[model samples]
Target: MGWKAAEKLIRHWKVLRGDNVKKHIKQGPGHEGGIFTVEAPFHASNFQVLDPVTGKPCKIGVKYLEDGTKVRVSRGIGASGSIIPRPEILKMRTTPRPTVAGPKDTPMNLVLEKTYEPKSGKGMPELINILNDVANGLGSSTNL
Candidate 1:
């Protein structure tokens, strides 16, 4: 699968980050209902993953928390266009954000380069199955 396809699949999973929760919360009088506080259960510290082929970092997803702290939580990839998984999926999972000591605590720079290599063999079909599993898993976990 091409980079475009991989990006599309990754993008779909981005919603799991809980960035849109505030918009879904209802407003009320006694409580600041609309203003919901969403603590990122998982923090993505290293936003840019190095492409094996290009040597350049590909901007995979947004890095929450301005601090350079690794948080362990359920994490997934997001992309645009078609959905395709790399032959070797490099994923990182972490919890809550850590305390920053110095300037390094700040969010990492965004790598806007599209440096993904085209996937071979199982392409779109395999990607569909993977995405389905991810979607189902996300749905069930959020219910709890």
Candidate 2:
């Protein structure tokens, strides 16, 4: 949208002579030093969210459901009136995580084992201290 909008603006302003021009002249090594068309930063209002359903540019509109949860939908300019799903980029994980416990994970039996000692008069503080000691390499797995 940025480069396309800038190109459209420049074409529309062709009548004016070198006035209010926003262009890039490439320089330095590996650069042609010729005028290069680039994207021009524009106002947020001019930005359009692509309608996934219609595969066209659209204005985003919020719709409230009966549960009072708001959902984004396609509105105006080739709108398909369908709920807009979140962007794929946002949903993608840079690194995939394991769903199941791995070899490095603590055994379930050990994790479920109780370390509480009510007779010692130690409560959550004792558990915290044990965890801190383990993290600092002062405690063994047996202490857990």
Q: How many residue pairs clash in each candidate?
A: 16, 0
Overlapping backbone residue pairs in candidate 2 total: 0
How would you encode candidate 1's per-residue C-alpha lDDT over 1-144 as one tens digit per residue?
Answer: 999997765654432345534544666777655555464322344344554444454544333345764322222443231222333333543564555655655344534444444675343565556667777775443333
TM-score of 1: 0.17
Provide the global lDDT of candidate 2 against the true structure.
0.76
**Worst ten in a row by lDDT for model 1:** 78-87
Question: What is candidate 1's local distance difference test score?
Answer: 0.46
Best by lDDT: 2
True-structure RMSD for candidate 1? 23.7
Top TM-score: which candidate number? 2
Off by over 4 Å in 1: 1-15, 35-87, 90-144
Please give the lDDT score at residue 66 for candidate 2.
90
